[model samples]
Every structure is written in C-alpha cells, then in structure tokens.
Target: MRILRTWECKIDKEIEKCKQQLNILSGVSTNRTTVLKIINDVKKHKDKALAKYSKLYDKAFLSPKDFRVKDNEIEEAYRKISLPFVKSIQRAITNIWTYQEHIRISKVSPLKTGGIVLDTLYSPLESVGVYVPGGAASYPSTVLMNAIPARAAGVNKIIMTTPPSKDGAIPPERLVAAKEAGIREIYKVGGAQAVAALAFGTETIPKVDKIVGPGNVFVTLAKKEIFGYAGIDMLAGPSEVLIIADDHANPSFVASDLLSQAEHAPGISMLVTFSELLVEQVTSELNRQITKLKRYADTKRCLKKFGVIILAKNIDECVEISNKLAPEHLQIMTQNPRALLCNIKHAGAIFLGSYTPVALGDYIAGPSHVLPTSGTARFSSGLSVNDFLKRSSVITYSRSALKTAYNDLAEISGAEGLDAHTRSVQIRLNSRSGF
Candidate 1:
C-alpha cells in the first residue's frame, strides 16, 4: 500500500481501472431490462406483484390486511423502550423541522417589471411513499429522514412501507417513528414490491406523488424504472465516505471514521490524505483496530476493494481530486475548515473538523442521512424538504404589459418557426390599446 514516488500518476491510473465497478455499485447485476420487466409487471398486477416479490425475495407471505400495524403495537413499543430514547427522538425531530423550515424558500413576486408579475409557487406533493429498509437491521432513522421532510413541506398524506417479517408483522420502532412524524398510512411491503406499490398503486395502497428513502439493489433498480411514473429522491447506491485529512489528523480518528462507513457494507469507505506518512500510520491503525471489531470480515473486504489510502502532493491537490470524485459524504479534518469550504464544489454532505464525523451526521445531527452517491452529487443533491415539494412557474401580464412586449414575443415566436405562437401574440397585439 506504499503508493509513493509518482503517487498522483499511480492513483489516477488505478482510479480509471476501477471505474467499471465504481460506476453501477448495483450489487449483483445492472440488468435494467429485467428490472423494467418487473416494474411493468408490478404496474399491471398491483397487489399480486407485491405478494409474488415478497415471497420471491424476502420469503415472507403477506396480504393487504397485514399491511396496517395495530394501535396496541405502538403502545407496546413505547412501553418497551426507554423514556430518554423517546425524548431524544422528539428533540431530533424538532431540530430537523426547525432547520428545514429556516431553509424553505417562499414564493416571491418580481417588482421591477411594471404590470407584469412573475412568481414561483411552492406546494407539497399530495401524498408521499417512504420506504424503510428492514430485515436484519431496522432503521428508525430512515423513517425520520424520509417522513420529516415530507411533513415539513406540508405533504398532505404520508404512506410508509417496510418489509414484513416471517410472522407478517412490521417492526415497532418503525411504527413509532411513523406515528411521531404524522405519517398515518402504513404498509408492510418492501424491496421492489414496495417501490412498485408506491409507483403504480395497488388496490390497497394509493399511488403516491413521490417516493423517497433508501433500500437494497432491487429497490434501487425499481426506483430507477419508476422515476417518470413518480418522482424519486435519487438513485442511491452503496453508502460512501471520503475523508480528506492532513498530517494534523489523528491516526485513530482517521481509522475510526473510515471504518464507520466500511461497516455499512462491502463497497464503502475511502480515505485520501496529503501526507504519505499519515496514510501509512492510518492504514496500520485500521489493521490494529479492525481485528477487535465485530464486523471484521466485511470491513476488511470493503477496505480491500473501495477503501484506499490515496496520497496527494498538497492540500489543494487533495481538494481538487475530491471535487472530481464528488463522494456522497466528505470529511475535512484539516486546520481551517472554513478556508477549505469554498473549494468544495460538489458533495452530498460535508463534515467539517475532527469533532464532526459522518457518524454523527448519520444519526442525531438533524440534517439528513439520505445522500446522493456514485458521483450523483455532481448533478443532484441530498434528500431534504425541498425533495418533497414541487414548484410551478407563474406569469401574469396586464393588457398594457402585453402591448409593450407584443413585438418581442412575436419576434421570438416567429424566429422559432411556430406560426401559431406568433399568431397568438399577434392577436393580443391587434386587440390591445391599453398602453
């Protein structure tokens, strides 16, 4: 792992060599054709598709009746959990709501143009479908991340779907998070089935205006297939973290941060630093600490595949390379984080300083854990309240205003070779005398 001498040349060549694997990140296959077939089948069959996929993938049998969680389950969950945990979830929700509200942009009117008004109308989607990953791990955080944004944007109806267990019961923590976020509708559906049900409504589940949240490969592919049918947050890939550190960065801190994402799965985690000496120290630290960790095998594989100890010549060179990568999460652990912030052009989320790790932002930091991956941050953004809302461009012109701009409109319309568009404007010009 000693990438020295012409280190930049080696790093760039190796990055190109791994481009194919890094492109899709779609677990087993990227067979979009089969995924489309599944999407179309679900669109046509509805609840039948849900049942078939549930059996085929999750090996769980469920019906529409089993979709709804009982009231007693919620009460039981509260009874079983600690009071302090409940309070913490409440506090996190409050902070998330406040931050989103402060950033929410309101419709504005342009006052410069006399008698002509242009505004942007913002309104929430009528309904949203949130998919929370299940099985071995249940993320109440996913529920909060997806639902709170829709609730903050004033989405009228929020429907949630999670995979049912073999007993055909949804997890209580997910249910608690749903209820706390004002999500009234719940369904026990997951994977491609859940995406299908949300995209093309089943007999029981209403079609949602937009679908949001993260899932496995099947779910991600299904979202890709159903995008035009319904709005999606983003085509999420494997969880990723890119740390840009310096010699000042602690080796243990660097190792811990890298392993934090590596523990997510087998294709996450990357570390790039300016100091070659620091990379050696951090790699040794990772080996020392990973042996003591529970998920050593998976972490080791992740580190072997996508995990890298890139050595850059200088801090500016490291920043340049990071912009090219545009990772889902970027951690800047060098001195003067504020000075470097201006250079970070692309990232799903940036964690500044040694104290702010990606782990903290993943849980209680109040921003969002659902982020864009696989270099999508170059074009898209992370999940937020803005994802739940739609904007309509507004235009209003008085007769006087129309008279003033009639010539310009006609000229552009005629130049574009649309006679009807030109005639439409000409008609207004012929009839207008207000000016």
Candidate 2:
C-alpha cells in the first residue's frame, strides 16, 4: 500500500512490525497460558479435554465416541461432494504421491572399506499425525499436502485431525481428500487441543510419532510446546509472498498475486521493483482489484498494514533484498526470471515467470505447500517425504578392523579418562593368539 526506498531505514522497522504481527511468537501471554493449559488438560484428562475444547472453541459438541471419523461419515462425505471435486482431488493425490515418491529417500548400500562395513538405513515413521487447520475455514489442500507424503514414504498409519464445522461434521472436501491420501484414522478436533490430543494419546485419538501441517496461532503455539514430546514439521507462521517484477511484468498479474496472498487475512505481500511506473500501475491495479474479493475487508487491511513496494536500484538489489527477507514464496516477474535464480538463495519456494503464480504451489503443484516461514527458509525447507523418514547409521566391524584402530581408540579414550571404554576394547584383544 506504500512505496519504500531500498536504502531507507524504515524498511527494516516496517518489516519487523509486520513480522511481529504475523509471527506466532508475537502472540500475547494469554495465548501461551491458554495453550499450555489446553495441553496439560489434554494430557491429564485425555478425551474429556478434547471434547470440552471442541464444544468451547469449535462448538462442534463432539463426544469421545464421536472423535474418530466413522465409515458412515466418510461415505456421507462422498455423497455430499461433487464429482468434479472428487476427480480434482484424485488427480492431486496422484500428483502429490508421485512427486513425494520420486524425492523420497532410498536404501543406501553398505560401504565396505577393508574390514569395516558402514551403512545407513532409512525407515518410515510408524505413525504420523496430520493437522488440518479449521476454525474460520477448511483446508482440503492441506490434507493432501500433509498426508500423501507420509503415505508415499511407506508410513504404516497416517492419522488426521481437523476442526469440525458448527454442525459437528468435517468438510466433505477434506474428508474425501483424506480418504484419497490413504488417511483412514481421522478425528474431528482442532486448535491447540487437537495438537495436544495428537501429542498425548487420548482414549479415542491415538498419539503419533510426528505431527505435520500448519494452523492458527493457538495450533502453532501448541506445536512449539509439544516439540520434544512429539516431533513437529516446523513452527510455521502466517503466509507471506515477495514478488520481484520489472517494467515488462503485467500490473494486473502482480496486483492479483499480491491480493491472493493478502486474502489469507494476516498474509504479508511485498514487491521489490526498480520501475516506479510499474509501481504506480500495480498500486492502481491493486486498488481496482481490492473491490472484487470476497474477503475484501480482511485483504484490504492486510495490504494496508503489511504490503509495500520497494524501489530498488536494479535487479541485483532486488535479489539482495529478497534474500534478506527469505520470504515464504518468492516470485520473479522479470524479463528472464531464471536469470535471477543463481543470485537468489533463500526462499521457501521460488516461482519463475509471470505465468507461475503462488497458488499453483499452494494447491495443485506436486510440491508440498507446507513451507518454512518467518526467515526460516535460510535454514529449513518445505515439508516432504524426507520429513517422515528417520535414518539410522549401521556399522559392522571385523576383528582385523577393530585391531587396526585399537591403539588410536585406546589413546583417545585414555585422554578422556574413560578407562571403562578402553577396557571394553582391551578385553576383546587380551587373549588373542598373536598377542
């Protein structure tokens, strides 16, 4: 909604302000207290706490018996949804499953170095919990993105947890997607309570080895809280997109992309471009497009508070600024989008050219849209089959191999004053015939 100079100090402050607004850590003390209480209650009381919060927060009024999604409900879901929607979900499931399988880890052959054999074994997690966020909205895409990868990784069980609508029913779209993704065990619960229920086994909802997906502030905070107890994918914050455009880029396209991100309500949208004329055009287009959105007020507020167009000196400066932010979604709308690829290193996902919008990555694209946010792309990556697999290092040493390294091992253990470690090795060689 405003123009910022690349050299201006206000750039940092403005970005920090919006980040604080978008980050889960920026939540008030009450949120943490609430999340902790819900976690504690769910751990101690189990299904009771789940039911209590389901009634209090989601107003679903589900009981312990109603927590698990029954077969009848899934059958009803098929009846409720349209044929086109089912076909679309089926196609998306195939695409996601194929992509995840392609990138999934494979068996590593043992490395035989003399008498030593070293190998790495990759095994899928026994069970995984997929958290699909719902309160104001339902995310069927989230179901596919989170669950399909686990299935492709050969995980034995994939459980799903999502908030229910006021009518105490999960959305037919989400249910159908879950079925296609091979997630049979689903519970009608969400928010912090849903996360807690997944972390600690309730009477009905079983605990899982790891939890994956995105959610609101409460759910994100709950994931942060239960990280040690139950593995989490990432501490994802609100959605964000950064677009770099040149004068040749279409103003309408740029504005539409920015608006798409802003429609997430608290989403942050930014543009780094050298062309002031394009800025003017995009801003005008934004104003014109703002009136057509269903979520007009929320999107307008997000754009007003968090959106900005930065006037960079050139393409290099644009890339430099983008790397610093490490935005969740980076779109290059320059003449040659791939030309900027080498200079750009930090981004959750990168989309090249004007035709590639962020929504493709969000919904139908093969890659999982569950990406790192809040500058985390510098260190982490998007969710995939890799997250569901655990690796174990296997080592088998022959007698000759152990004897060859015995002296060094003994000396190192001696230096550490661990006599027991040296003795354990020494005992093996004490009565050898050569000795």
* Segments of candidate 2 deviating more than 4 angstroms: 8-22, 431-435
The TM-score values for the models, in the order shown, are 0.93, 0.96
Across 230-303, the per-residue lDDT of candidate 1 in tens digits comes to 99998888888888899999889988988888887645676777787788889889889899878888778877
What tens-digit string does per-residue lDDT give for candidate 2 at 1-435? 878886775566766665566566774589999999999999999999899998999888788998888999999999999999989988888888888889998897899998999999999999999999875666899999998888888899889999888788988888998998888898899999989988988889888999999988889999999998899999998899999999999999999999999999888899999999999999999999999999999999999988878898888889988888889999999999998999998999999999999999998888999999988898999999999999999998877898898999999999999999998877877757654
Clashes of each: 0, 0
Name the candidate that leads on lDDT: 2
Model 2 / residue 20 / CA error / Å = 3.6
Candidate 1: pairs in clash? none
